[model samples]
Target: MDEKFLRKKSFALPKVNPFIHDLQLSMKDKLQILVMSFTLAPIRLFLIFILLIFAWLIAFISTLGLDIDSKKPVRSWRRLPILLLQPIMRAVFFCMGVIWIEQKGLPASRKEAFIYVIAPHSTFYDAVPCAIIATTVVAKQDLISAPFIGTLLKTLQPVLVVRHDPDSRKKTIQEIHRRASSQNEWPQIIVFPEGTCTNGKALITFKAGAFIPGVPVQPVLIRYPNYLDTFTWTMNGPGGLTLLWYSLCQFYIRFQVEFLPVYTPSDEEIDDPKLYAENVRFLMAQALNVPCTEHTFEDCRLMSQAKSKDLPMEAGLVEFSKLSKKLGIDINEMNEMLDEFALKSRSCKDGLMGIEEFAELLCLPITEPLKELFNLYDRDGSGKLDFREYVIGMSLLSHAAVTEKSIKIAFKVFDRNGDGTVTHDELDHVLKSVFGHDFETRNIYDKIDQENKGRITFDEFYAFVKKRPEYAKLFMTYADLEQDDMPQDKIHNITQRRASHALAGSSILSNVQYSNQGANAILKEKKDE
Candidate 1:
């Protein structure tokens, strides 16, 4: 699928530059991760069995007298079974230590059918719990495969879909449109618009299918309080049964479902479901206190495949080798900085530091350059440094800050044709992302294309960046730039500036795109301890 079409405009990736919000877990929180890992709870295990038995019975009884096809009002006496059985299920939830939505938290009026959107779905519990008040759920097509549960699943009346299949998507949308338009008999449509489960720490990009019906949506945000984070599904993590057993072991599983004000789309928003969907996602993310990842559900699922092999879904942890390789830095140097970063951190024995700690990293006399490096590489502004961001940010600050090899590697990123040369088209592709202008692209090309052969090889590009003292100085900070050729007086001025620094190296910050904080100015060097 074309990304532009699938993507939501309002789902912005936050920047981690100025704010140093480290995801600090309290001592209690840290202990939760430990307890859940080691302890086995037999009490909750038994409770889950009881709940399952009751759940099956409730499902069958709840749908007994309803004309599912008939357009009946939710308040009708026919839905009495559903209403009565919901509280019984909720009692089972209480026994299982499920903390869910309160009566005061639900929409004041329950008469109207709402197209509900829920987010931060860590497990099936996110949806199953909604039955306490609402009935219908939008599930996936795979539900048909389950033999026994297939019958019980009928109670939810989920709008199951096969992702990425157009026919399935069309059918599901038509179903929703028809039912939403129907006055009676339709259960409120509950959709997990993110289309997959997450760890609840971050909001992934939303799918637009939920908004396609052009109905007002009641956005619900779900949060599972966990330290070890056994709730959300992962690629290599525990399976559903394993997760259920693990949750049973926890001291208690507490989850919250917050129903925000109903979001009625304006005429403009109705026409653009993508905008409406993303805007709703943005609102949910803000309420949940999580950042937005640029990845979609399918994107995260694919990423999880690679992570399944060896990479854990650890927060603020990146592989040292991968980081070194991407930034073209020596692994040893990156490792050294990582060691120092952990030492200076409050609780980084794990070798991970929040982006704020990294911003304040004091290996170099000037921490400004380090912060600038951090701001540049901290793409999502997650306020914390993952392995990749840490490696790139610190590698640039280390000795090979902006050498010929690094510069060449950077250029190759824009060398789309693999021609060992960067043509105007390639430069256009690159500079457009950086400056977002063709005029600047043309200007940058004219300056670097020393041969004027309509393109520039690595050699010409290197020479263009090398002679200027500004290139080296800029390398010491964030956001690199090009300069006009220097006269002898300018060269002499550069010489005087370098002399005044009285250090082994003064000019380091190169013109790679980086975040611009107070540290954007490069002043001194990273002293060798």
Candidate 2:
């Protein structure tokens, strides 16, 4: 990865913060420190865990005499230890000499219980102190048993949800309603609606659970300001304990917390929790000045897994099986069939497919589904499919959920000039490259040119995709859409191979051969080129 190439503002630069012009760690220093850091970490990790257990144990022990269901505050004497414990924990972290959390927002007003939603959950520690001040939080049942953090979380009275059980989602929501509506002293409910963590680089989709309560939401954005990426949890990078070790090496880790104004939804929005959640997620992303993505928690989970699987490999070319492995699939079942495409797709005798080889792998008479997959995966528009591109394409196709954001991003891959439109020439070039013939996509072009303008804007392209028949299997969607328009050819017979491959199936695609020049044939012969 060249830091000089196409670096977006969204990706945090690997340099020091101008405000903290201290000498950053060198690679060798980091390795040396990383090894030493963990040796000291277990003690620190254990100390923090004990601090949380004691704080909660004391708070709960003090509260036993009071009416558990009362909304009224406990006697100041009882509250004193609980309040003092939070600050003491903060001081302990500060004394540990590695991290400092700077919280800027005024605590949520106690007048009314509101939903506190946090963003940019980069590490496991992102939600800690805010969770303290915000009172209680909604969490999974497993967190209670999670080492070091579990006892502390239990003190917070986290509303826990079960996984994969019947009525689990409903049960979780009901718990939220109970806690949010309770007259008892359950602190305001805190939730990380993004449902997963990131590197503070992007804000992905938010889960809808937070909005179900239909109450005012207090949105908080958390950013780990770092010269060393203490914020990111990488796939193949050091494991959690090692990352913990690295953070322990930070002379002082600082974070920025911004509390946006409370957003009160209208009755209409309250009734539509999905709409409400999306609106809030969008607002937070805008406030953070990051591009909003349509990826969900599942997308992050799968991508993280795929990244881990490849982290051990060298930087460049990867095997076809490696590509499928990232997508969490075994392609050996289809290897016999894949061999045909691989032979044509591999640009080098090294048996690896680069972008160009993959993009232009198939011949003429391509189907809609395969064409869309190609456009989605070609990435750089250089007519190649590397390991990364291949995984993303196959993941989305296999997952069967195409987000609007993904569609918009993928559509631009075909708009070669970056002019916001896929021009006739652009489509012509792509089709010719893929099929090895200048087959006219006249009908397809006309369909995509919704305004009959001879060009396809992203909106037009998106519309064309949205209108694709959902019934068609992964790669066969478009095949069914234009079966009537396709030319008669023996090579066109491979479109439904996904079904034959059984459980470890994939998008249906076929090899194509153009046997007829036809009147509209724009294909060039070998000599013509």
Candidate 3:
């Protein structure tokens, strides 16, 4: 990669750090907030609390004998108190400075669309929509235990979701499908399909819960048109209390809710809920006048992980949906690779690895071949590797070629001294023995033996082999070429035959006994394959 060319090349996707929002306050804005803090904030706070207490009292009385978790919805005369609670909730929003809400396009009737999908859910301020619609919502299970808020949410008969429970997601989806497909038995359910907050500059990937039922959905767009934004709460932004304090101090907050036309799925979309979700998201994004991104909530988890490991939080925003699709790697695999990247970049800063750190990671010196490999991974040729490039390069170069059997065979081949150690000469000797070729192994031994020992241990040999998976591929290729009758496509055939031939031949591995247990396991794998 040419340094100049790489610097000029544009990335495939625009970089949008949606997990962060840096609120800039001007002198005048600060003065206004300071004045309002003593003037209107206390009165707003008091009135808001009073409204919440009254709403909670009504909700508590109405839901006294109702089964909040019932498979059936509450109906008939029992819903009278729940009906009475809506205006009081609206009153709460009024006291919080959301005096009037601007609406565009009429909301869909329940018979037409039972699911209302909302987006750009940036803060608790989004609760304004729930109060406006007076409908049930999908919420986290923990919210049901909140002091006064619990009873209020229960009155809506929400579909509460539990985190970290294996069956919770499945149940949530099934419940959504049930409610959406019912015959006017349940109130329309509201879903925030982004599943988390963003800065609202772009639309992130949407979760499929709202579309899984193959039902028509109303897309609702939210906007905070305030001149000075104190409403965005993201992973690295202001906390809820701080944003609330600032919002309460504002003279007025402008909130707009635009309901797009009800979107009914086609046959293809009905068969694939993810596609249904993407189409709806694109429509909403176009209406909101923003671009759609492949970043998902999983990226936020990665950002948190990066912060915990002392890296820049933005380092983990890898456009996860796009990269994962292109690389054919899943989040679990990417997470494991992050730990390895953390180990290599600990001595570096800005969550990037320079040439020195790259060399250290591979247990090699800055030779031409090593630098060539490093440059291959440094996509932008900034002379450094970010976590995204590191993961792509490593998955492409190492994941397929490095396996448990290959590690053992390579370790056994390289440990030529029989004292369970390999010097530089032994590494070269094993390369020649296995591949009938010589490789430049200069300084590899000294680098692997960090304590300055002349020879490297088996663990060191194994680690080196893992980091350089291309060497394992080379060994396997030579073994395959040696036995032309062996099936080249079968991995176990190559590994099994290599171990047998190396042990039986009059060569470096002749005296070494390849484990029978390992051989039997390989045989079993071959049979299973």
**Best of the candidates, lDDT:** 3
List the candidate 3 regions with Cα displacement exceeding 4 Å: 1-13, 400-468, 474-529
lDDT of candidate 2 over 56-174, digit per residue (tens): 67765665555432434455576666566677567556534435556676656745436788887767666555534746677777776776556555445566776444387687787
On a 0 to 100 scale, what is the lDDT of residue 469 in model 2? 17
Distance from true position, residue 154, model 1, in Å?
A: 0.5
Q: Superposing all C-alpha atoms, what RMSD in Å does each candidate have to the true structure?
A: 13.9, 14.6, 9.5
Question: lDDT for each of the candidates?
Answer: 0.54, 0.54, 0.75
Better-scoring candidate (lDDT), 1 or 2: 1
lDDT of 1 at 15: 44
Please rank every candidate by TM-score, starting with the best: 3, 2, 1
Better of 1 and 2 by TM-score: 2
For residue 126, give model 2's deviation from the true position in Å.
1.5
For 140-229, candidate 1 gives per-residue lDDT tens digits of 677745754654556656677887677999888888887788766666777887676656667666778878878888887776655555
Off by over 4 Å in 2: 1-53, 56-85, 96-101, 131-134, 146-149, 163-166, 234-236, 304-529
What TM-score, over all chains together, does every model reach? 0.51, 0.55, 0.80
**Between candidates 1 and 3, the lDDT winner:** 3
Clashing pairs in 2: 354-385, 355-383, 355-384, 355-385, 356-383, 356-384, 363-435, 438-523
Q: Could you say which candidate leads in TM-score?
A: 3
Candidate 3, residues 352-457, lDDT tens digits: the string is 9988877667654454545655676677668989998787666544444355776666565566456777777777764444323433555566656777777888
